[model samples]
Target: MGIKSFLASRKNQNKITTHMPLKVSDYMSTKLITFKTDDKIETVIDSLIKYRISGGPVVNSKHELIGIISEGDCIKQLSDSRYHNLPMTNNTVEACMIKNVETIDGNMNIFDAANKFLESKRRRFPIVENGKLVGQISQKDILKAALALKGHDWK
Candidate 1:
C-alpha cells in the first residue's frame, strides 16, 4: 500500500475507535434503592447506612422523582435540636431534601455524566426518564468505569 493510503486508513481507524459512543445505561446501576418523599429522616439515614450509599432519588407516591436526599441533608438536620428530637411524624424527607434535583438520562455519555456530577457537587445521581426514577449513577461507578477502561480493576 502507498504511504499516503496507509496513513489515511490508520487515521480513520483511530477516529472510529477513539470516538466510540458511550451511553449512561452502559454504566448506571439499575438495582436502585430509592426513598419516598414522606419517609422520615431516620429512615433515610438508616437506608444510607444499610446500603452503604451516599444518596439517591426521592420519589413520590406515583414513583416519580421529586427530590433527592443525601447524608449531608441528615447531617444538616442534626444541627437543629428541633429536628433532632422531633418525632418521625413531625419530619419529612422533603423538608431536608434537595428539591431541585439534577438528573441524567440513560443515553448520556459517561464523560458527560461525570462532568455533571462534578458540576453539581453530587456524589450520587438518580437516573431518570420522563420524570420517573429508573436507575442510579455514583462517583464510585464512574471511577470504576474509568479504571476498567484503563484495563485496571479498582481496588
Candidate 2:
C-alpha cells in the first residue's frame, strides 16, 4: 500500500476557528478628547493642536453627543471673524460645530464602517449607547484593526 500523507490529513484538521468580522468596538477609542457646546472655540483649537487631532465630538454634561467639531469649522470661524474685523474670543463650540451629528453603532462590522466613512466623507464617527457617548472610531482605527489581523481571514 502507498504511504499515506499524514501532513495532508493534518492540514485538513488544522483549520481552526472561523474568522468573524471585526467590529467597530474592537478598535474604537474610548478615552476621547471630547468637547462641549459651551467650550470656547479657542479652547477647541488648543485641544486639537495639543492632541494632534483634526476634530472631536461635542457632548453634553451627561456625555450625550450633540455635535462634531473639525479643523475646517474652526478655520471658518477664524475666517469669518477676520472678514468682519471682529475678534474670535467669545465664540463657543456651538457656533461652528456640526450639530446634525451622524453616529455609528459599535456592533457594526469593521468593513461596513469603512464604507460608511467613504459615503459620509467623515474622518471619525462617535459611538453612542443609550444616548451616551461611549467611544469613537476612525479610519486609522479600522486600518489598525486590519493590520492586527493581517494573516487571518477577514471573513
Candidate 3:
C-alpha cells in the first residue's frame, strides 16, 4: 500500500493515542512576560530582552488581551522612525502591535496547534480561557511535547 493510503487507513484506529495527545496546558508556558497596550516601546524592548523572549501579548487595563507585540514589530517602529527622521522613544506598543491576534484555548490538542504553527507566520500563540490570557504556546513548546511523545526527554 502507498504511504498515504496506509496512513489514511489507520486514521480511524487509536494507535496514535497510546498515550493521550498533549494538550496546550500541558506544554504551554504559564509564566508569561506580557505587555500593556500603552506601554512605551523602549520599555517593552527592555522587558523582552530581560525576559529573553522574542515578543509578548499586549493587554488592556482589565488585563484582556488586545494585541501582540514582537521584536519584529519593534523593528518596524524603529525603521519608520528612521525613515521619518523622528525619535523612536515616543512610540507606544499600541502603535505597532498586531491588533488582530489568533489565540488558542488551553484544552486544544498539540497536533492542532502544530498545524497552526505550520500554516501561519506567528512563532507563538497566546492561550486564552474565558477571554483572559492564561498562557503562551510556542514552537519550542510543541517540539518538547513531540519529543516527550516519542519517549524522549526534552529537558
Candidate 4:
C-alpha cells in the first residue's frame, strides 16, 4: 500500500466514539400527568391509580408548578382522623401537597439529575422550563436511560 493510503487507514482506525451529552429534555417523559392545587385528595388518588404513577406535579391556572404530591402523602392521610370523615372532603390538594419541592431544569445533564435524585432520595421530579411545568423525571426514568445506554432493556 502507498504511504499516504496507509496513514489514512491508520487514522480512521484510531477514531474514538464519543457519547452525546444527555439532556434532561432528551430523557424526561413528555406525557406529563399533572394535578391542580385546588384538586381534591380523592381526585389525586384516582389519577395516581389511573396512571399507575407514584407522584405527579401540581400546577396552577397558569400551568406553573406550585408543588408536588405522592402516594406517600396520600398514605399519611389514611392515618389522620381529620382526613377520615366526610368533612375531610373539603380539604384541597394544596393542603396535602409538598410545597418545598425539588425541581430539575430541562437543560441539566442527566448525570447531575441522577446525582440529585440519589442525594435527595426523591423518586419523582418535575421538569421545569422557564418556571413552567413541561414534563417529569423519575428514578425509573433515569434507570431506564441508564439501561438503554448499557444496551439492556428494563423489565
Best by lDDT: 2
- TM-scores for the candidates: 0.77, 0.86, 0.81, 0.81
Q: What is candidate 1's lDDT per residue for 40-100, written digit by digit as tens? A: 8889889999998887788887789888888988877765646567644446787888998
Q: Candidate 2: give the clashing pairs.
A: none
lDDT of 3: 0.87
RMSD (CA, Å), each prediction: 4.3, 4.3, 7.5, 4.3
* Per-residue alpha-carbon lDDT of candidate 3 for residues 1-47, written as tens digits (9 for 90 to 100): 64566666777674453555579899999888889877999998899
TM-score of 1: 0.77
RMSD (CA, Å), candidate 2 to true, equals 4.3
As a whole number from 0 to 100, the lDDT of residue 134 in candidate 1 is 84
Where does candidate 3 stray beyond 4 Å?
1-21, 152-155
Question: How do the residues 39-132 of candidate 4 rate in per-residue lDDT, one tens digit apiece?
Answer: 8888889999999999888889888989998898877765473655545654567888899887888888888899999899989888887878
Q: How does residue 61 of candidate 3 score in lDDT?
A: 73
**Clash pairs of candidate 1?**
none
Write down the TM-score for model 3.
0.81
Clashes of 3: 0
Each candidate's clash count: 0, 0, 0, 0
